[model samples]
Target: MSSAAPLLLSPKEVNLLKQSPTPISILDATWFMPNVARNATDEFLSKRIPGAQFLDLDDVASPHELGLKHMMPDQKKFSQACERLGVTPSSHVVLYDTHSVFSSPRALFMFRSFGHQNSSVINGGLPRWVHEGLPIERNSPSMIPSSHYEPPHFDARLIRDYQQIVENSKLDPQTNPDAEIVLDARAHGRYLGAVPEPRPELSSGHIPNSFSLPFNLFLQKQGTPDGEYTTFLPEQELRAALDNVVGAQYAEKIISGERPVVTSCGSGMTAGVLWLGLSLLGAKNIGLYDESWTGYAMRPSSKIVKTA
Candidate 1:
């Protein structure tokens, strides 16, 4: 792993890294919706890329009293989790997921927020690796001693809390010039209150004034003998999707670091897809609403809008 390794690595590049003399850490950062029956760790134990360790998103998250899923952990907790996972400040952390592009980017964002800049996500993840006839193994990963990491303060610029999101929502361009555009990554139906949310207690609607750009628009599905698997869309398609939602001018500003963008979704999982798509375009000043709609809609103080 060179100092210049890309943030998004291909399956072939990962194969090359396997043969490299440089120290690299491969982590399977697979996570699924609560409604989904599959357990990510169990799936990892059943099959994974050779020498890959499980980086459970749930275990890395700080538990909420309101039962929110995958909230960002505190700095000490994150440091301990990374150390336990055998990651060091210098390690080229390679993130991948069982479900193509889903959870790996979230893990990447977590690493970046924790000031670990040497991490990258496998572009198509483990399914693509297996689809290319790459090797797989079921044996437990070899145990390595902890790195005893002392992490830097979490990057507040990369995250937006409920209070900040609410304040941003109320901003008028005439008064507050630095307000960020809020983008919701949930499906249109959910965003518009036409469909029920997965959580029975939560209502379907988006934060006021947020644009509805579904996360799936940033992905493509390729068919294999086993089944259809998801991967990111081409760079051109990603740009077009962003253009369609935010308009080409604003999209260009977002890519060029002139405008800020904050992404949100159901409990903040698929928001990572939006963040990763923007990153591919070399976008800057991006933030994630970690509490997202789950935290927003649960509070009576927050306003929700429905167009459907």
Candidate 2:
């Protein structure tokens, strides 16, 4: 990938949007947890980036039958949706949200999983944008006539389903494939079985054989009402922490190239935070466990092993 391909930018790069001549599109991807009373689409319509269009997480995702929320939709479905949204292969995409949250990165995960390379989440999202008093077009953006889009060759190797983790928990070395790595992005307490789950229907504890690297551990400080998230880790610190978690047998796969990680959280929200941090650290092979704890915890078929 070129140095310019996945342009993860700070406020500096963001301010250059209007100055650049080449086409750049920003996506207002604010979304809420499923249990929340507020809907993402409705919230977006109320206020958003000037000229920013909404990206519907549920509408654009694969059918949710796997017990996972918003898994990657099929290539044809993704392409068609992107085409309708004015997203093209070459367009540089800036994904953002109303709050300084992980919804922006979730959109990045979706587009990348389906083979869109030129997209990234704006650091701090709309909170920062608003704080800076950047122009925000609250009305709908002008839509272009749909364009022909080529879908990425389906990479089944990318996604990790619930059954696969269940299988990994039971099987010995022979059955444990080295091709993919499991990344649990839950809080350290949840991963260690120390804390109770946020959801009641699901049980506690993480998958056996999974490693705990809490997503918030990467965020320098949780953003305050008066401030947006200021990611604080030094480059060296980031490299050291990531090197340790990814140093197992999964090391080679991570070192080989980009796109080798699988992120999972209590449900699926924090996984995006983990994925975003991994991208900032320049880790390769990123993915998300869509079903996450929702699918694993209650499964009578799967085993949950707690590790320190």
Candidate 3:
């Protein structure tokens, strides 16, 4: 795989790559909420990209006693999972999900955190691929067992713990110039405490000083004769959205690498969308609060802010 791979690939680009002599390693990282009746694995088994393997989010995540979902796994565990999925150091890993841009970014985040930079996500995921008449197969791809892929140490710089977030919450950016910006990717209602969280045990509120920029804002819907599909917005429009959420000055600072950003969401899934958006804008200093609100709100020591 070329190290200079683009972070996002269109379905047309992906289709052309599949026809190459050495095709890319495509992963179906489709996942859904517990209440959703869909089974990602079963769906993948029935229909998926022609040469794609399934990446079970639950199987790769660390088992949390507190039930914090989608927590990053240890380097060894992650390395094993990738090897089992036939990913190698030279593989140009391409990730996609059944939903329109939902779960694939999280899987891409996991790859980047594990030091695999030679990877990309299908821009509109499987939905858009199907919408454009891309080839798919019901049978699983033939696996060429990876020769003990060694994952580099998990990038600590891309991850934030609960305590780190709490400390950040107490800082006033006005007082501390280096204070990081925290952005939540949950829905507006959930961020405002006006909508109940899907997790019954958790309350709906945001971390102090965190801005709510729903993950969907980064994507634009395109209506076709077949149906509607979602894809990332053009760069100019995305920059405008960022400027509107956090002033133009702050957005410029982030793009210039002078300011840092940490993204969070209900259980740390959609947070990747925020991280990916920032990265697309050329932001180098970005982190994911893996535990996110699920790990934060449950702790009595952490403070929660409710606008509604």
Candidate 4:
């Protein structure tokens, strides 16, 4: 909790700060899967944390100009959106979602990319909070009046374009070596081409030379059967899980800002979860492949590996 980097806050930790004089902004950034019919806005309107604002990921954080889903917006657009949400530069933002650890991490990563250093994600999101008997509001909270928000120079190092990914995919540690490590956060079945992709046009498989480390591995089920919620593991367990993929020494290098980590997923959404995990460990050189497999699969020249 005392670390300089962003950390996940427990429900109890959030409750203790209910009376703190510092400005804390809560954001409900719930985003459902494509097949799910539930509307996040309607859910937020029905019930949400007290004083929480709704951030529509598809609307507020996406770049419509690129014709892609949930792409990061430019600095000016992101600044304007944050201003409309009444998020000042000094605000300590806390994001949560209905689906536990799914969508909130994306919002956290977005905030960090925009140079907001004080952002964090609730460990188990709304479900855990409700399960813990914390207070909730039925009516939609009134939005604070707009404020001015100016972001620092946008950092391109936090993002990896398709060309960069393609180039990285070709590097072989056995022969040509590089400091960059590419991680894929998709299911093992999807990564091995044993399961079909959600998108029909995109083929199932993974980027060449990328290691598989599904994002859900970091999450553990909490709460009772009636209201089960997913939350991140304890620091020791989380570190062990990460060390399994990148080895303990390399993981330490990543945490100490010595090596670069690049994360990718089906369409770039779950990649945020991996980015968040690295960020929690204080990894400074983190990058996300914005287009992910959706873009890579469509390119005939891109290298893809399938176990089956």
Off by over 4 Å in 4: 1-6, 62-66
lDDT of each: 0.87, 0.69, 0.86, 0.82
Model 1 alpha-carbon drift over 4 Å, by segment: 1-4, 172-177
TM-score of each: 0.95, 0.83, 0.96, 0.93
Shift of residue 156 alpha carbon in model 1, Å: 1.0
- How many clashes in each structure? 0, 13, 0, 0
lDDT of 2 by residue, 1-308 (tens): 11245536654576686468856677887777766788788778778776677888767777765446666778888888778777767777788877665677777777776666777677767777776667766676666667657876666765677877666555433245553556788778878877777777666677766667777566565455777554525556655566677664454446455325577887676788777776666666776777788777767776776654
Q: Across residues 1-308, which tens digit of lDDT does each residue of candidate 4 receive?
A: 11233568877787776568877788899998776789999999999989889988888655533366778877887888888888888888889999989989988888878778788899899998998889999975886999888755677788899888888878863345474788889898999988988877678998888888999987898759676999887777878888998789878877887767899998788899898887767678889998788878888887778997
- Model 4: lDDT of residue 25: 81
Q: lDDT by residue for model 3 over 145-249, one digit each (tens)?
A: 665578667878899988889889888754677788999999999999999888877889899988889999999998878788788998898899899998899
Which candidate's TM-score is highest? 3
Give the Cα RMSD of candidate 3.
Answer: 1.6
lDDT of 3: 0.86
How displaced is residue 302 in candidate 1, in Å? 1.7
- Residue range with the least summed lDDT across 10 consecutive positions in model 1: 170-179
